[model samples]
Structure formats: C-alpha cells, structure tokens
Target: MNPEIYSLFDEPHADNEYTYRHNIGVGIIATYLGMKLGLSKENLSALTLAAMLHDVGKTRISDNIVEKPGKLNEAEYEDMKRHAIYGYELLKNIPGIPPSIALTALQHHEREDGQGYPQGKSGKDINLHAKIVAIADVFHAMSSSSGYAVL
Candidate 1:
C-alpha cells in the first residue's frame, strides 16, 4: 500500500474500521480492473490511489453522521454529498499525486445515467479511473454490512 494511503487509514477521524477496510477493498478491486483493462503502470497507480482515498473526506464528518443507525434527513444527506469535494480539497495539495487521483475525488459520484451527486456528470464526462473507482466503491458499499446495510 502507498504510504499516503496508509497515513489516511491512520487518521484519528478515520476510526470507522469498516469504512477504511471498504476503501481498501475498493482500491484492490479497482487495481485488478485496471490491470484487466491493460492500463499502463502509471494509470494503474493513479487509479489505485484514487480508490484508496475516495472517501478520505468522510474524516471531516462527525461519527454520529457517518455511523447513524437510521436514515439521514435531507440536510444530513446534503452534508454527506459534500464529502467528494472535501476529498478533492484534501488530496489536491499532496505532492506527486496524479491529477487522475484528484479527479476521482470529484468524479467518482457521477453515474452513467447522470443520477449522482456533486456533479450529475454522465457517460464519458467522467474519467475512466473515476468510473472504475466508483464501480468498486458501490460494489463494496453494497456488499458490506457496515456500509449500506439494508434493514
């Protein structure tokens, strides 16, 4: 794992072990997808970094908000939507970070049909790396009990 990614996991605010593990799972899935797509080493690295830190901005949210046992109100949902931009802000200044990684923070919420958050970007408007990360993120979140548990 990249040192930067490891440092993200070590953050005090990232105490939700479920989210951290989910992020790592997404990164691993994205990495494999990138390799299968025949992405260059540099591209693979960038995608991996993007997947790893995709949820880093969640650190700014309170544990109560992230760990709510029930559904969130509209206001709370709006706050949750800001995490992607917050993630971009957190990763943008890191030295040696690829633009693709930062872009993932902005574009990962986008959907193929344009039914997503932050930006309602659709189809090719989103980068390939971001798309891959988004798919992996949703996959992990849906499959993990602590992520999107359907009660």
Candidate 2:
C-alpha cells in the first residue's frame, strides 16, 4: 500500500488526535460490518477506505466550530453540518475514487427516520455502505468518548 494515501489523514489538524482516531476506528469497524453483511472482498476494501475518509470534509470547517469545547449555537451547528457535503465533494473530485466512497461521506449522517442533515434521505435512499459506516461511526464515537466497551 502507498503511504501517501494514509498521509491524507494527517493533513487535518495534528492537535485533533480524536478525529484521526475516530476515522481509523470507524474504518476498521465498518469494514468488519461490511464483511459480516456479506459484501464482496472488493466491496469491503472500498468500505474501509470510505469509512476512514468519511469525515475528511471536517478539514474544510473552521477550528472555532470543529474544535469548540462547548455546544454549538444553531447557526454554528448548521455550518458544521456542511462537512458532509464538503467530504462528498472532496472525494468525488479525486480521480478513480469509487462512487460508494463519496456517497458514504455525504450520507453517513442520514438516518432511517429521515431526520439526518445535508440531505433528508431515509432508509433505502441511503447507500448500504453509508448505513454500515454510520453504525460503526456511532459505536466508535460512543465507546471512545465514554471509555466503555460496547456490547
């Protein structure tokens, strides 16, 4: 594997180790979930890459919003949510990137109940890989933030 590919993750703020860790953790978990869901090996590989880069758009966000220690105000939160669209644009522009990868970046925040942001896509409207990455992302975020072993 090319180390250059991984170096992209390091492009984000070095002080935000949690974001880096979250990306890697979600990648592993999402790939595992994909495998368990009977994805082909090619699909699993794409899932791993997609999950790791799912939050790449956060780089486009301001440090004030992304690194804030307190809850965001309504306007700030709206701006923060643009990271999804940013991520999609970033990945989709890269030559040879898979459609699933860009879609996952854009749609991972989507919910089955259609309450998610960037787009109100619900249920089947969301890509399967995006759905799996969403679950893995939440699990990892909760476990890492709470220091608990999720069952």
Candidate 3:
C-alpha cells in the first residue's frame, strides 16, 4: 500500500467522517488480506487504492440519504445503489490509475450469486480486486463501531 495514497484521507473532513472511516477500514483490511493472498506488490497497491476510494461516489449522494438513521426507502435504496457506477465514472478517465482499480470500484457490489447491483456481474465475470474489496467493505460495514452498520 502506498503511504501517500492512504494518507489522502488521514485528515478527516467533518462532513465526510463516515465515508473516511469506512473506506479507510476497508483499505487496511483489503491490504492485509491481499498480502496474505500473495498478491503482487502492484496488485496490492491497486487493491489498496481501490478499496480506499470504493465509495467515493457516496460523496455525491445527499447527506439525508447517506446519513439516514433508519432503513432507506425503496427509492432511496435504488438511488444509493448507483454509487458503484458513479465511482467508476469518476475514476475511469483519471490518468495513472490502473484499469483494474476503476473496474474494482465499478464491480465491488457484484455478487458471486448474481444478486448484486449496477451490472449484476457474477462468478468469474467479476474482477478479483473487486471481490476482495467487497468482502472488506462488508466486514467494515458490519463491525459494531462502524456508523454504516446494518446488522
């Protein structure tokens, strides 16, 4: 993991605190897991960066929707699901970022069982880095301390 890339969110922004903490946790966990899985240095770096910014699109979401204390209404849930594609669109054209990183952001919510959002990719169709980020994201979101906890 590149220190500078990770350091980008080191100074918390008051409004983005939830996003900052959640993405940081996902990044740390994904980096450790990537190392454990023997990913190459370059792959691990991409994974770390992708994990850190996987939810960058959430910044575009209305705070009322993102910070809702209870369940999102049906329409809000559908709107929220667009974050993956929004993140992908935000990242795809950026110079220097690996294509895998952008793909990871696009596909992180895709499930192995074909029950996910945006593209509904499943099984081998999903990128490896995206799968890793998805697991890490869920782990962080489900942790008791995370404000995004659903269960």
Candidate 4:
C-alpha cells in the first residue's frame, strides 16, 4: 500500500473503526467479485482502491454524530450525509488520483432509486465503479457480526 493510503488506518479511533472496517471489507469483496466477473487487472485495482477509500470523508465528521448510540435527528443525519462529498473533496486534490476514484467516495451513498444524498444521481448517472463499491459496502455491513445492524 502507498504510505499515504496506509496512514489512513494508522490511528484506530473507536468511533471510526466501523467506517474503516466497512471500507476495507468493501475493497476485499469487490476484488473477489471483480475476479469472478472477469474484470481487467487495472479495473480491479481501481475498484479496490476506490472501495477502500470510499468513506475517507468520514474522518472529517464529528465522532459524536458518527458514533451516536441512538437514532440521529434529521439535521444530524443530513450533516452525517455530507461525508461523501467531503471525502471526494479530500481525494480530489491528491496528485495522480483518478477522477473515477474520487467519484466513488462521493457517489457510494447513492441508491439505484435516486434516493441517495450528496447527489441524487440515479441509474447510469452513477458510475459503474461506484455501483460496485456500493454493493460490496452493503454486503460487508450486512454480513459482518459488528453492531452495524441498526444501519
């Protein structure tokens, strides 16, 4: 892993661990699915990297909101939703990072039904890589034994 990428996981904040594990698990699952789907090596690598960093924006959000034990009020939830765009902004200026990769961070929260936040993109408006990362992210969050059951 690149030093910069590795640094993202160096500090394991109690609240952020769920986000970290969720992103990593998405990468792993996407890689496996990419192989099964016969994706090219370059494509697979891009998807994996995108998946791993999809929630990097959450690093900028408040732990009080992210790790809250109870349901979030509407305003709080909206604030929490901004992480996707925030993550994209953080990755956008990084030298050599592809636009597609940055977009995954921004678009993973998007739903097929156009109900997602940060951008209400629907169907083909969402990039294919983002779609793949979204599927992997959902799968990991649902299948894991962690307390993300309420998500």
TM-score of every model versus the real structure: 0.88, 0.90, 0.87, 0.87
Model 2 agreement with the true structure over 1-151: per-residue lDDT tens digits: 3344566677555577777787889999998898888999888988998899888888899999888776788998888899899989877867666799889989999999999878899989999988998899889978886442211
lDDT of candidate 1 over 1-151, digit per residue (tens): 3356557655524566776687789999999999999999988988888888887777777777778877988888888778888888887777777888778987888889999878899998888998999889888878777647311
TM-score head-to-head 2 vs 3, winner: 2
Model 3 clash pairs are: none
Measured by lDDT, the strongest candidate is: 2
Model 2 misplacement above 4 A: 1-7, 146-151
Q: Give the range of the ten consecutive residues with the poorest summed lDDT in model 3.
A: 5-14
Cα lDDT tens digits, model 4, 103-139, are 9989988889998877899999998788888888888
Q: In terms of TM-score, which candidate is stronger, 1 or 3?
A: 1
**Local accuracy by lDDT, each model:** 0.79, 0.82, 0.78, 0.78
Q: What TM-score would candidate 3 get against the native?
A: 0.87
Candidate 4: C-alpha RMSD to true structure equals 2.3
Error of 1 at 74 (Å): 0.7
Candidate 3: give its CA RMSD in angstroms.
3.1
Candidate numbers sorted by lDDT from highest down: 2, 1, 3, 4
Q: Name the candidate, 1 or 3, with the larger lDDT value.
A: 1
Error of 4 at 122 (Å): 0.9
Using TM-score as the yardstick, the better of models 1 and 2 is 2
Per-model RMSD to reference: 2.7, 3.4, 3.1, 2.3
In terms of lDDT, the poorest run of 10 residues in model 4 is 6-15
